[model samples]
Target: MLNTACLRIHISARTTTTSRISKLANSASLNTVAARCSHHAAHYDGPSPTIAIIGSGPAGFYTAQKVMRELKGTKVDMYEQLPVPFGLVRFGVAPDHPEVKNCQDTFGDVAASPEYTFIGNVNLGHDLPLPLLAKHYDAIVFAYGASKDRKLGLEGEYKPHIYSARAFVGWYNGLPEYRNLNPDLTAGDTAVVVGQGNVALDVARTLLSKLEHLKKTDITEYAIQALSQSTIRHVHVVGRRGPMQAAFTIKEVRELLQLDDVNFSPIPDELFPNDLKSLPRPRRRLMELLKKGSPPKEGASKSWSLDFLLSPKSLTWSSSDSDKLEGVLFSKTKLEQADSPESKVTNTDETTLIPTSTLFRSIGYKSEAIPGMQELGADFDDQKGTIRHDGIGRVVSLDTREWDKASLYCSGWVKRGPTGVIASTMTDAFQTAEAIVEDWKKTFDSRRPVRAGWKGVQAEAQALNLSLRPVHWSNWQNIDQVEKAVGVERGKPREKFGNVDDMLKASGASG
Candidate 1:
């Protein structure tokens, strides 16, 4: 069990220096007057359009950028529940995939713009009611990405040794919320991870990388220690569907083949349908790699299996005092073509059990509706767990095509129904922003302006008794300084502040 008291909040709050503000104003003055006028006109013309973005993810940041750029003088405030910004980009993407994180630089640029204010460490439903925000801002965009994991819904899933792949990944990646979730790696030599997506591959690879070959990477110190002490020798990655129906991409599949001690087993031709065999060369190469079963020559231990056509039915635990995960019950499955090109799999209903000490399920993600918005007549899809929006991304009531008076919007995984890579999310964000701009144009002069400027907003926020940790540009610079300094102490590239309060204190924002 982890101690919740150890988790600390890092607050970065300090006013910008006079020199910096003056420099920004001076530089901003050089831009064309037409551009400036057009920007501010979107907010001041109708009823001062106060825009609130409920997330700080890629989609939220991109949407904010588009709105600020096109709407000019709009009052846009972005709220993030985390003390730090960048949702999955910071905590979900693997540390090795740093290039994908370049998106953060772009997000940082948007956050720094004068047109926006980043209110970090504020939970939407908890800190401020959604309806209240809607009333305060002309528009509210719920860009909060799916944080919960999909369950296997099997018997005995509540067993202690079982964990959701989402939590495990977050734990290894040093997410403050899940940093202390240390699984007992010493209990068993072998483990099983269910699902066949990029996330599944990531978990498998991270588990396999426990060998000495990957010790140099920037894995969390605690994760590194736990993995180094792991007793497991093999991991079986099980997928219900055949190779052709697998959700994992070619790149991630190939990366798994390169692991030092692991082996990649190629699927037999009989397992794939005739149509799938006729796929283009790139996909053929992926299938070809899936067919070879040669173990690597080096590493701490050998043996990892990729088992297909297996659906987990239950997680069985040992009756002994150890009370550990004893095995998983599964049913064999077969795939059949659907009406469309995508195929679907059905379990034969026959069952078998495989003994294992640990299990991880990585089905998918689901979105939760923000609280207090239901009264405003917000509609949600029960099957998809997504907010129902029209082509322009406006939240709509179930009864009609008209917009809900609350004018709620969404982007990222929540907007497009939890599918796509970061690049796809960027495209979705751009589309949502375009729609918001279009909506603004129609109601530009009709909205009422609130008496709040930056100063008044600051005063109101301060009066709320919220932590005034300013996380100003200088504070970020200080954080960078401390991170680099600590990284040097450990002989790594950069050591992150695992504890949030320590980071704030080191940045001089917390006394």
Candidate 2:
């Protein structure tokens, strides 16, 4: 029924298609076998590498920046649990310190790369098994920061008025997890912070800062209201060490000493190094500043002190109401060797109690393993509270005692532990990026293409019938614009959305 010429042409086209499919399907028999974008990832013969970065914090962004620069054909897919990016910058950083967040500009530049993909609101372990991601990505970098807080194991730590510094900071910065954390700031006139870290100073400063000053920053409206109604008039930043071994940086200490109407109680001279000149330059300067304590300000109604060489013993409750926190009991401690960071402390026979209605523990942060990490041949250090890794950030396998992947890597707090400021985090992240590049080049095959990262993951998720609502970079920008617009009306730099659902809605993504 068909013309001979037309039938012949159709038959030739079909033959060409069959020949091409057979060639592609059997290409593994030739030279290289690579899988990508299939139910398990399809095989390909190209040479570009694909990478997945599992956090949107400063460390993650910095690592991605370095990797992208070093590997021209590398693709980076960043994952975040929050609808927004800039993990700590947006949540952990104090709102008043906008200068520290300048690094977000660099992150913005990195996100703008065509090879970069921002996958926000998709929790790596919660939304999909971590091992499943390993199938798609040639490498996975864990930068999901410390999500838990360290505890002192003291009695009554979970008492009502006692708060962890992490929660307090999150509450003020509008982190969705703590948005509804309505801390009863009006319940106390005196507060005790049981650590001498920078975070402790931040907490103390926020409680003491003038509302007019706070209003100029992007601190949440909710936090502003709670602080404005606060009855706190005294703060004690206590530590189980001397001023010489204090954890606070000089810049933060200076800020506290300079607050407008706040009175600073002088640190004991005995706690400082006797031969100040013999100390390091930074310590010398800090010691000198401490010695020249802020001149007692006239009409200074509120005050704070750097109480040293004391460990928290227990919380004291009101005699009249067992549930009401009345004060804190602390054991006096003596340093094993004074004026040294490594010095240990021993509890003395003496104990002291300071009456107050509130307490904040600023000890430190703890990083825990995601549920599915072990399935990926990676193990979290239960004792250390970190992912098991080489000092340089290569995730390690306990059984094989080798690089967990030659592929799995880590950066930031998850790699090193929760310490240091953003600058330190950037440096560590760069080191991890370099390690990843080094490992990749060492094991790379010229003929084989890297497995598709997000592309393959998308396919797998679809195949598994999982709904993943990812907020891409463009979506985050829309959310940013909305936040800024709202901030303008409130006369603040940028009022953040304190809830996750609202953040997704603003970004035009369904939560």
Candidate 3:
């Protein structure tokens, strides 16, 4: 259901290789061709401006592509905490939605340019202090993305069988951090997901999908085994608001409805507008589809639903086991006006209990302050889950004393809260690049002193004893092939290596 709008976004945001002795000979030829190409780029032909853009996700890559295309003598060195790149596209996209991952092709094109460089496996503010970047690069773009998840604060939310959507998505998608989640899906047949976002739907779809559907995807082998043994049958995606205010896109909902042998319980018509023509095109289509629902096939084996206008209060425990989840207690909510997007909700006297043994908290994702942010004179807004910015992408200090026009900035989830899709993220990133390019031109002509790109940064890193072992584009290409070869042997699209050491070893990344 990922439609043409997403493809158009790709068109709007439209923006690597080999080999030793034989590799060295190939390397030289490639270098010669690259040098010739760089000289001809028309924009990046002169001494390049050093720009350090942290994080290699869509934001960082798209920003780099736009900057390199718009500015002459501009070189970008992308820094990633992991040896692999394409942050969420690699670890957050649902395994079955291979179409959404198509943006990787555009990112790949950006990385192939001579003006662009890949520096992976180096954690900013940790492996090297953030201030160290100031001395080497002319500009620093923080795009590390959200590293933490928002919690439900419910009393028993941490008990066994309760997981955040990020962890669940990460577990199946092979994120190194959540590889050992090993959620107990056999506890019961019913599961409650406390959110109505696309992620919640993805979790529902994965749980209810046939094992055959998952086996052919790029999902981790360990997750494949875990899901194959799941006892899950029903999924309830609960939300604080009614259908009109739901955050999920029509494509995600349509995909779930179309799943083989999976049943979608219809959404109540009372929650929707009386006249469908009153709603926008997207919402009207979505509401109509939801009201019609997917009637289960003759012998459908599993089912899911959109449980709306319910505010989760707490997780109830089973009588026999205190640590195991049994149900979610929700307070019924009433809409203030209902048909408008600005409608608000308030708790009502009614209450409902959903029986379940497994739970997922998918309210939303929150971004954390990158370490060493304060010493650089920029502060992270704890309340907003973002860095303090001018709302366009510039990191500014509200406190007059700390302000230095710091030339420090951020984009993507770290700058704005994590919300949009790849296409949306691309739009956000391109805007950030515009801001950056505008600033760079003015700064380049000013007395900001002179600097070398990554070369200068590497020299400073060595002097600072940062102990950084970075992976380049070539290394990623090698590790990529290794992962694909492994996948081919197992009959899947690709099998991800879920550990940092394994990827570095596969890349043969040297100090």
What TM-score goes with each of the models?
A: 0.83, 0.88, 0.89
What lDDT does each candidate get?
0.65, 0.79, 0.78
Model 3 CA deviation exceeding 4 Å by range: 1-48, 397-406
Residues 194-247, candidate 1: write the lDDT tens digits.
987777777788887744544454457788788888887777888887776676
Model 2 clash tally? 5
Those runs of model 1 whose alpha carbons end farther than 4 Å from true positions after fitting are: 1-49, 210-213, 274-277, 292-300, 338-341, 397-406, 450-477, 507-511
- TM-score head-to-head 1 vs 3, winner: 3
Quote model 1's TM-score. Answer: 0.83
Listed per candidate, the RMSD to the true structure in angstroms reads 9.7, 15.9, 8.3
Tens digit of lDDT per residue, candidate 3, span 129-160? 77867766767788867767788889977778
The candidate maximizing lDDT is 2
Q: Predict model 1's lDDT versus the native.
A: 0.65
What local lDDT does model 2 show for residue 206? 93
For all candidates, the clash counts are 21, 5, 4
**Candidate 3 lDDT score relative to the true structure:** 0.78
